[model samples]
Target: MGRIKKKGEAGNAKNFITRTKAVKKLQISLPDFRKLCIWKGIFPREPRSRKRVSKSATSSTTFYYTKDIQYLLHEPLLRKFREQKVLEKKISRALGRGDVTDASRLERNAAQPEKTGKPRYTLDHVIRERYPTFVDALRDLDDCLSMLFLFANLPSTTTVPAKMIARCERLCFEFQHYIIVSRSLRKSFLSIKGIYYQANIQGEDVLWLVPYKFNQRVVGDIDFRIMGTFVEFYMTLLGFVNFRLYSSVGLRYPPKFDKAKDDEAAELGAFKLEGNNALAASSQAPAQVTGGADAETGPDPQTQAQVNKLIRQMREADVEGDEAEVEAGEEETAVDAIDKFEPVAPGGDVLPQPSYSGEETESLFANFTFYLSRETPRQPLEFILRAFGCKRIGWDAVLGGGAYTTDERDPSITHQIVDRPVIQAASQKEDGGDEGETSQQLASNQRMPGRIYVQPQWIWDSINDGELKRPDLYAPGAQLPPHLSPFVQNTQGAYDPTMPLEQQQPEGEGLEDSDEELGEGEEADDSLAVKRIEGAAEGMDLARSDDEEGGDGDNGSFGGFSDDDNAAGEDDADESEDEALAAELQYQRELEAELTGKPVKRDTASPQSKAKVEARKRLAKQAKEEAEELERAKGMLSKKKRKLFEQMQYSNNKKSAEDQKLRAKRRKLEKQKTRAKA
Candidate 1:
């Protein structure tokens, strides 16, 4: 026979451990345990049966897998945490004994370990252990980049230090340098909250948003400590990723950073890169060594993975010689090759391709030089131009010093992006003021000769359309066209303002165009209907009182008295409608006789007019055709899918109605303008 198992010794009890127990097992404080879990990529676990795992389990109780807790025992960061705890105790003891100087000294030494000859811990191993491959890191870099960029723009608060903000900004610039060099940027969008960007790096698509350059308001709701923890980890991760990317292209990592240019907010211009010969003995060198340079070079993704492998080897070699911090058994870290997630091609025949002799859209702006007005956003314009193969871009002197030319009259400029309004030489404002002329024109804004002046939106619209848009439409002070979002895909049957009206309008609305156009006034011709509604309301009140009073059905006269009062009410309504129709017909006949200057003869027995009969029949035919089409479509869908399709039809019809209303308003305004001119 086998030995009997004890309670809380096997199965669920053995597998699951509570948060308190995990913290105890790791021999660290709760905060330290949280940090460790975050760095090691460990999360809370839920057991199938809480009662089986722990007899006292409750909804608030947090649990973790026993194996994960056990694995945390070998983490090198645990030693640093324990060391910090001891240092804290030493500082507290000194303060309690009134040795304030000693306590302050301990704190300063711990804070500045380099100056004090004390070794500080870096999360190098944790970064490698968490993400074994560079692509793995890149896949998760979306959140990292967004958070870092946001904090980089935020003001320094008591919660978030200035140094942290500076470092975040520096890292973000470094990452953008890599993006520019690689030319991996695929798309950009201008959104109200921020600008969004999508890039394809190493066949993996990454999308992230950057806040507009407005003063960031750090609200009270955010927990800076938690975000700071994440920022710390991401900083290390991105550094390593940058190193791998730079090494892949045989370019030096950390390139050259110019403090003077950075101080002046020269941004992307502050960093310069060189070939591999610029490398020092190790990768831990400072960023200030290299000088400033332009972003004219980048790395190839084909060799990124290979470079990561080499870096991993170097990391492993460096860790192997460390002074007895981690145990021999714990030193075994098997960082496997990248786990690829390639998209499978659909099984279908290949289609023919269209060839063109025109320049590719990637180089559409390559031949032209652009000069931006002072009012235009220099950074976004510069980035877009550089990404799309435009080499020489100039801006105002106040903006920065890195432009190709600060002079607006630069002869080489082919395009000038201006956001200012038109100036009429001040004549319209001064001389024509007494004549009620609106001073809507600028006084002195002249355009340079041989340069096409367009609004800032022209650049974005041209890039999105994959061709240069007509310059006349986007000219300054030319009632610029609506700047549509590039990210919103145009769907079939949806109302898009950019598309022709006749193409996407609903069938029913298009048919009613004649009636809509012929309508003379906005007021409704409902005089008879209003009288009938008043009469109906008087009868409805009397009926409601009768029902409340429990009166017998004695009011209906002339063989109409019955127990059912609803049928009598319906008959009364029919009689009232027929009387209203008779009154309308009599009025129409009188009007016709007055217009023709002849007596109007009544023909009660005559059939409906031929036009009316044909119109009714034609409407019936159209409705029948529509019903048949709907049936055919419905036959191909399941009941649930049919309901969803009907919902989409309702939404599309509503949107089409709105678009038609807008179009009608515009037509009315245009007619008013024409009448005023006449």
Candidate 2:
């Protein structure tokens, strides 16, 4: 048998250290320890058995790996924290002794490390340690972008300083500038909670959300201090990312920012990109040739002589023999191949690839210009359209700046995305009298010629389908189809809107099986036939009464029992009386059939039964005429009235859709309950 193990000396006990013990080993306060742990990506650990890690009986012990705690001891920042602790003690002692000036001097010296010749603390090394490669940084960019964007839109409070907010906003703007120049922005969506943006950066897709302007409500439950810490880390990360991106494009990192322009809301325009000197020179060479300035600088005499000699050699070789010509041809082909594979730029450095090549693809809106209305979300629409290769995207002036063309009435604008209901201004009279009032009166239904107007959903649908859908389906007043989630995958036998739910369900699993069980032990067909016979007898009595009132003797009269006799069953009737009664019923039936120009036999295939088909045709025709008249009446309404009518229709349709969603949710919950019960 092995020797008995001591307390806290077996299994994970030796591998883990408690938080309090780690903090003591680092000689730092708990808060400082936590900060170090967060920055270094160290998290608390839970041993398989708490008793093994902690000698105490308490179950709520937080543990960290012994190796991780040992690693923290080597962190340079730990030395700074010790020095801070020492300074704090000195300051407190000096104040206790009433030497205020000494305490002040001590605090001031500690704060200014540069004056004291001590190194200033920075997180640059920590950033490198956390993210070893660029792809690692990108993988973590989603959370970083979300935190920064949220802080940028937040209002400053005592806990959240204004300076931090400004820094976040500046970093976010710089990142946006990179996106604009790179054209890596892919898609965006306007949700009730916030706006979502997805971008493809270096082949990695990153998605983040941004709250609408002035929409964030700061609640007390959230800890701003922790968020501020995260923001600080992300700010440094993004700055480095922006630097790398700008450098890749041959543009100087941290592009010159115009403070005055930024203050005036010149978002992307405020950055002035300066190309690298080498790139600038290379780009200028082509400009010089295109500008015809190279003509003034004639070729050197030696270069011209060399070119002439090369041509003469080539001609002489061609005339000499097939051997010389073959040699020259081989050399020429080799040179051409080398040139074809050579890098386009000097020093074998290739130009950065553009995020979008709009010219090469078959763009859906290649020939159209779009104008977004003020109420619609512009950023997302602009980004998606441009991604699919739409060049000119404009928005109403009310939507602010940064548009290709803000003028809504521009002749070149071929499409407009509007979300609000149409309102036609009253037409103006030739005379000036009461022109305002007349113009206020809505005009008749009309539309602008040569231009198409659609809702904002058209853009999303077109992009998802990879083709342009018919505009009429998404027109302002048109009944739109349900907007299904593009992320949801369709499976066989799944519920579909076009097919009834019952039809999609398997026969063995349907409610019909349960109904059949409940209907067992009953003659369903015979009961149904008896009910139909009773209803037909009542119809015959009504027909007889009508015929009697008309005094038509040609029509047969039924010799059935009176109401009193019918109520009482004829139990005492003799055989002769029953036969006589049955014969009288038969005679009445024949006479009635003869009067109506039909045989006594009930043959539905006879010519007289065709009247039922003619009656159905007449009813269908009347309904068609009524529907046509209603449509014509709608067309006659004024524009304002029509718009109001359309708004009502839209609201009703939206409400119905919401109701359907709620019902579906309830049904899902009910199914879950049933499954649980089973």
Candidate 3:
């Protein structure tokens, strides 16, 4: 009997809405609806069947979730869009008569509060609701951090406002300051997707991506209004996160930034944490305790008297002018000690001496400067370097607006960052005069067809040299910054078991259908049958037939063919035995063959001896299989056993029929191809 239907089983399937229906339900143009959905992060759903909901289902065509449509009606953005359209109409009408002031007045009036109106909704609640706790916010930080960093490095366009870019830059700087002071950075890698950085926070490994210096595109589909709303929310969230991070490390949040040093770094395209003004690093000297706090302190009388004697001797020696010599020798000795062994505790864990450090900054930053585009910001890049704990950064004045030291001869200056290839070419130009002609020539040289090239090799070199300090400098983990990974597909977005050969043979295209069908049949069988056997037997028959046609006596006889058949059967059995061995053994053998390493060998024997050996092997294999089948039968439920048995029989019959049909098809196709060629 058919099973009884459960409650809600038939009618409880999930109902989804189509794009057309959704657009109609919202009473907006399809394009506008699509825009709303994308901005809101709403995703489309797949229907179980076209009969239930599809474009053909109705005259207007398409279906939608009645509930989802009802929820969308409450969207404030949609209402705002509608209101803006009305305001735009009024403004346009006023402007049509050349009433510019009147149009402005009308626009202002429309923006003001009415007597009775709906309260404006902001993204404040969405931010809090999405990220309830600090850690929850941290988890979402990958997306937040990447987006912000990308925007910070982007050029100001109509789609992306300069103000928004500046805000993003400031927030990024604030976040970086927290990273620098806390020194929570662990590791970073340069990736094509972006620079990836990982840090440990509260025993959790937090990874984030940071984009390259400047490589963001303001695409049309991305709704800046929704993004701006999110940015506002994240700005507040990051403010709190930064505060918490600083306070935890016993450092003041928003520590006094030295405007002079900031200006200097900005000029030089580097920011150094001020060591004297505000909360200076020097102020954090280790505490020294005097003798009387814990117990009654008394100096040993003999020791004190001996110290006084040494002091008096030293005073007399100083009178002799030997103190200066002693001081110089001590300084040398201290320098030697520093050279011999200097230990550091990175992240509060004992580590060997750093491979890169401040002492190497001169060499590190030597010729170290970036030439920014006319559109690139000098402050943001400088701030970024400082945030990553690099106090010595330099950029070309073409970018820093002559606010920086442009002296290439300056020994202290290290790294140089440049975006324009023309800057590099012009600076390296042989002739200094005819600047206009030189620039035009350089501009022409810079143009490359079919590519908007941003050289990341400079970033990579700096990162590898350990000059770029941001934890996420090298795009690592999920924190890969934007455009860090290059555009390339490692694999075609499809599955093919036989595809691995494409790598081996570059000239090879796709496998033919006949070959694929054969492969599929073989793989489906899940048996250790040798494909070479059929071909080998045919070859043996042809050899014998040729010998017979030549009238070769014993060699042409069918008697020896009996032994050949037996030998081939024995080899097939041995191959089947190898197939059932451990998968690792098979893999290792293949690997060894590829490497031209030593291959494992089996003792060779005559076909009759091999047959005897394989016969025993087959018996053992059958015994193991029978025992496993018995165990499985005992454990399985009766209903499951019946179902499994039926499934096996159905599969076997289906496979037999498919094999026959495939053979027929293969013959027909071969015949057709031959005819076409003829």
- The best candidate by TM-score is 1
Q: How well does candidate 3 score on lDDT at residue 584?
A: 36
Q: What is the lDDT of candidate 1?
A: 0.72
Q: What is the C-alpha lDDT of each candidate?
A: 0.72, 0.66, 0.51
| Candidate 3 runs further than 4 Å off | 1-41, 53-102, 109-121, 192-194, 201-209, 214-678
Estimated TM-score for each candidate: 0.68, 0.58, 0.41
Per-residue alpha-carbon lDDT of candidate 3 for residues 1-678, written as tens digits (9 for 90 to 100): 999975323431336666665776677766567655544546565455655443355454444555666777887667766776678888999899899999989766675423223333445444565567878777767667777876777788876677767667767766665555544555455676666766556566677777766556667887776666556556656666777765555445554544564454343223222222233323332111111222245668999999999999999978888767777997877765533243355424333453434434323333334333343345545534443445444344444332344433334544434343343343344566556511122342343233222333444345334454443343211222333232222233222222342343212122223233333443422221222333343344422334334544333235556657745754575565354343434465468666886664222334433343355455655676577565556566587777797788688768656644544454466557676788
lDDT of 1 by residue, 1-678 (tens): 999999999999999999998888888999888888888899999899999999999999999999999999988889989999999999999999999999999998685532453346799999888888888998998988888888888999888877778878888877776665556666777889777777777778888888877887888998888888898898888888788877755567787888888776677777776655544334332232242243234556869889999999999988977756455445444333334444357633334334343247657788999987767888778877776778788877667767778766668989988888887664434655543232222233766667898998888888877788999999888866767777676654455766655565544443333333233322122233333444554454433333534544444222455536655565475456545655665687689899999987453321223233234435755786589568777988999999999999898879867777866665566567676788
Candidate 1, 100: how far from true, in Å?
Answer: 1.6
Range of the 10 consecutive residues with the lowest summed lDDT in candidate 1 = 517-526
Model 2's alpha-carbon lDDT is 0.66
Tens-place lDDT digits, model 2, residues 223-243:
877777677778889888888
TM for candidate 3 is 0.41
Better candidate number, 1 or 2, judged by lDDT: 1
Positional deviation of residue 32's Cα in model 1 after best superposition, in angstroms: 2.3
> Which of candidates 2 and 3 is the stronger one according to lDDT?
2
